[model samples]
Target: MALEYSDNMPHDEDDASDASSDVTELDANDFPDHFSEREGRLFHSHGSLPYPLPVDSPEQARLNNLHRILRDIVELHYLGPVAEVLCDVRGRQKRVLDLCTGTGSWPMDMARLFPGVKIYGLDIVPIATRRPERHVQFEIHDVTRRSRWNDGAMDFVHARSIDLAVTDYPKLLQEAARLLRPGGLFFSGEIGRYVDFAHGFSSDPAHQAPRAQRFFQVVNHSLQLRHLAPIADKIPSFIQLSRQFTVPTIQTFHIPIGDWHPNTVMRRIGKMYLNALKDFAESLKPMLRETGMTQHDIDNYVNGFIHDIEHVRGLVGVYHTAWARKL
Candidate 1:
């Protein structure tokens, strides 16, 4: 049966033209395994979820409905530029690995763009894509586990938002360096703790704006207790660890909430961010219980997020993408 989609669904072109984005075209023999591209969507089976879930959830259901629409937005908005970095074909040879593949959008798009390079998508959970690109493969493996790749096996290792499941990021970096073939690159993109936006929302006294402040604080507090390094502060050190890796380059972007911008479309995009967060708050009921927080406390925390998302203007959250190559 053909998959049904909603009227509000976002498309791959809703954002920018990635094809026009800068790129270095390369040959197919750039990696060990060579696979060509096919037309129709690659992933089937699992529906897409509203947000990528951590492996701890152990929820393996296909997000076919949610993923088909949202994955494109994430790809264009978040992963596109980084994909370009990893897909660069000007070098000697390129073998790419995308960790925390989500719905496998990043790797799939990269493979489609560079049909010659071999790209691997790694995630703890399975993805829905079935694109017969011999150049790409999806593997179910934990990166936090000791890497199985021999020393210097890949040209690039990329991870995005995998910190939600990672307890020790620096250790993960050390592992990524070990897996990189000499002169390979290691890149990571991470969501900053929402609290960083607290100050930005404070200037505006919108209805839900104040609430976004508290909700993010609670989430940030919980994360800090878990010992995840603040995303911004750690990127530099992560790149500096080894003699083979060069200084990391960092790029930061904002995911604006509900169209606080002057433009109508931007307002709509902002609204979606707010809505996504509200829906996300509900899962906290069970999540809080696992954390040993009282239900009342969880309710207050989640409610704050909902109110701000709905009422705040010019409210935004940020994420960082940093990459470095081995010398």
Candidate 2:
């Protein structure tokens, strides 16, 4: 079930915004006027001070690659391919809204694949560098606030990797439901946990000194300090209990962090995951320092952890994909 591009499809002129005009490139200075910098990381002025992640070029590149990796791993646009999942819907024009759309990779790909769908990508900053397709648009908007989209106006609402961006999961889900038409699809994908192992990554759980797990613990603590909740693992329960959505489904993928897997494809994915983890370590250093660790200690720990993971192998992390339809 492949999605065919509809070149003759009519465009939605009303939903287009001028936000992309200034987004020709991802220069730090080009970021919204409200964005502030601290320790070389960008933070939204409207958010709960000190956004957890960096919006710099390297981070944006990491996110763009990650979006591609996830799309390949999940192997679908929605619960199924766009054609199979949305075949029943009766409409010549479909609309999609990606909340907290980093780099706008997913929406841009969707626009190319499903040319009839009007794709809107919203984020706190305009980090997306790609020129918008005729049907795609990027906008600066915070996902936590009430959206300007009319009720039941969207056919599909997609959010991914927003665990750090969202403060209230339930409220966001509610907002997603409101924006979706009855029977419309809502897809949420997140990293449920930082790192895991089939048996356990640590050979000696108790005796092992502060290392990889400790690094994740400190990172989680830093996020907690910023009022961000680690709720990705619980999204399924949150959706099932909401009562506004039906047929909730969750698909979990365990990506190896290093080239430990025997299979060729798994090894390739493992290497990619390792590279991503390295980027994470760099991005997370300032935040980990906030957790009472000295700068010297933070450097030693992060370097040691990266070295261990690179050599040891078998470290894995869980990525969760949760989808449901509005009732």
| Candidate 1 structure quality by residue, lDDT tens digits, 1-327 | 111111132333212211111122223353112111212212222222112232221221222222332333344523433455545555344567777675566677667777766776666444325443556666555667764455666767877767756767777788888877666777777656663333445554333455666666666666555554466557767678655478887776566666675656555555665555555565335545555788888888787677666565566656577777766
For candidate 1, give the lDDT of residue 177: 84
Query: What are the runs in model 1 whose C-alpha is more than 4 Å off?
Result: 1-93, 128-132, 195-208
TM-score of each: 0.68, 0.85
lDDT of each: 0.55, 0.72
Q: What's model 1's lDDT at 292?
A: 76
lDDT by residue (tens digit), candidate 2, 224-291: 88778688889999998888899678888877777888878877878887888888889888677767
Q: What range of 10 consecutive residues in model 1 has the weakest lDDT sum?
A: 14-23
